[model samples]
Target: MKYLLRYQLINYLRTYKYVPPFSIFILIMVVNYTFVPNPILNSYSFTSIMLFFLMGWFTITLFHAEDEGQKIITILHSKGQSAYYGSLFIVCIAIGFCLSMVSVIYPILIGAFGEQPRVLHIIMGFLSHFSLAVLAIALSAIFTRELVKNRQNTWWGVLSILIIAVAIVTLKSVILPVKGLIWLFPPLHLALEMMSSDDSLKNIPYVFYWQFAWIVIYSMLLIGLYFFILHHKRKL
Candidate 1:
């Protein structure tokens, strides 16, 4: 298990497919803090959205990091589908964890906050960023090569879903009749919505409880469906 995880990590790094997403994240972080003394949660709200997109991009590249031949070889040597896919999932989540930490701590190091950031603010920033990262990964998982035969379409499919999911709040306001239908998408906006209110920040843990729980359940379903399809196709 340990070696398989390490193998996946090393393969991802050696491919350098991580470069663009990693570079873009750092570049945006610098730009995000260019105008100093930004409002804390507001600043966090914006970057968490950025992390959402980047994590989606990050997941795609990592998924394709190993070429078809190498992936087949890894699968043959591994214990089973569970170990292969499970290790990949863990590696992706681990990368998301690192990015989340950077998102929360970078602004503080640069002194970008309008006021002294409280412990609560720091916690919210990390949770928002990390939760979005996980959600993006789960959404992107179903759109990978196993199901999405066309490489180009897979990329656009993931992008379109992310855009629509994030834009649900706007869509709901514009299309009142189908608001219930629009709400079927993942509640990514809910993660950002609470952070927008000052009062919500006072009860950080309570405010995020449902949103966080929903994200967990939503992510698991998407990912489980993805694995089921991938496994079924491989068997066939």
Candidate 2:
């Protein structure tokens, strides 16, 4: 398991999928903070739009690494199927947390340089972004697995882009059972609720806690689904 993890981490660093999205994220933050004086508005804009799409792309690329044929065989044989996937889940969680923290670093630095926001708000934002990133990683794993199963490797990037694009455009009008379904999408739900509030500190609203709870629940469900898919694929 340790060997497999080390190999994955090395591959992740070498391929450098982390670079482009992270670079864009930093660029967005710098531009917003430089041009727009209000730190609060900058944070809100970052979380609402740039963070979502960039993180989604990052998640997809990370999981897509598993599609490399030789590496997949090496993981299965050396680590055993279950241990290989268990290690992967851990890797994904760690990567998600790290990437999410990277996403928030600019905001943290801006706060440090003056324009201090409530500590509680910063904590909640960190938690929300971390949870959202983990959930995105799990979903991307599932999507990548399905694409591999169907032998549709060519569509991987295209499908990921389309999914994010469609979700952003249609999320508002989605209603009823569908609205309930959309709520399961952590990025959109968290962005809408957290950004909508005027009070970031003094009155830490009930909706923040409510959204956090849902994020935790949905993250668990997605992680479970990721493991189940791995188990089923191992059998076949």
Candidate 3:
């Protein structure tokens, strides 16, 4: 199992040879922060943009890697595919959390110099980031599988763009009472919660309840994917 994960890890790292897009994202974040006078707004905007880019590119790269190896269906036959997919998902979540930490801590360190930031806030930031990343990765995993399954769809590209755009817009509107249910989509809700200070809604309805719901849904989807590959292999 360890070797299987390492197999995927090594190949994934090699895929980093084409990392200029990520570098450009970091550059854009830095430029925005350097010019923006309002530190709080800058921090929020920077984190939001970075998360958006990360989720999109990470999804693209995962599917591209699988496609490059011509292993979409072949991977389903491997005894190690379950661990391989699960480990890849784990790695993506870790990368997302680490990136989120960088996004938050970078601004805090620069803007809060002398005014020590609270440890609790930092911890919550991580939890918020991890939960959202897990949610994003789960969706990406499912989407990649579907794309492979429906490779001939003429509108897949258009559908992909629309879905991502809707996700981003939905995330932005999460504070609206009726729209709060959109928070079930991890990254959107996390962004909404992180950007807002109004805890009055917490009394109205437990925020954690919705978050826990997403985590449950995401886990089940992952398990379903695993079973899918296993069942297909059995038939072969």
Q: Which candidate achieves the best lDDT against the true structure? A: 1
lDDT of 3 at 218: 59
Backbone steric clashes in candidate 3, count: 0
For candidate 1, the 10 contiguous residues with the lowest summed lDDT are 198-207
Task: Give the winner by TM-score.
Answer: 1
Q: Candidate 2 on 1-73: residue-level lDDT in tens? A: 7787787677777778778877887787677667534655336535535554555566666665665686568
The residue-by-residue lDDT of candidate 3 on 1-236, one tens digit each, is 56656666576678783276468657855775675344353255446545644655575465456553556554654464555566666666666767777766776766732334455445444545555555555555555553345543313642464266446655564445665554444344444455454322223235644653565475467547656865685578
- In order of appearance, the predictions have TM-scores of 0.93, 0.75, 0.66
On TM-score, the stronger of 1 and 3 is 1
Candidates in order have lDDT scores of: 0.85, 0.61, 0.54
* Residue 210 lDDT in candidate 1: 74
> How many clashes in each structure?
0, 0, 0
* Model 1, span 99-156: residue lDDT tens: 9999999889889887888888887788888888999999987787878999999999
Q: Stretches of candidate 3 above 4 Å error?
A: 36-42, 66-78, 112-116, 145-187, 198-236
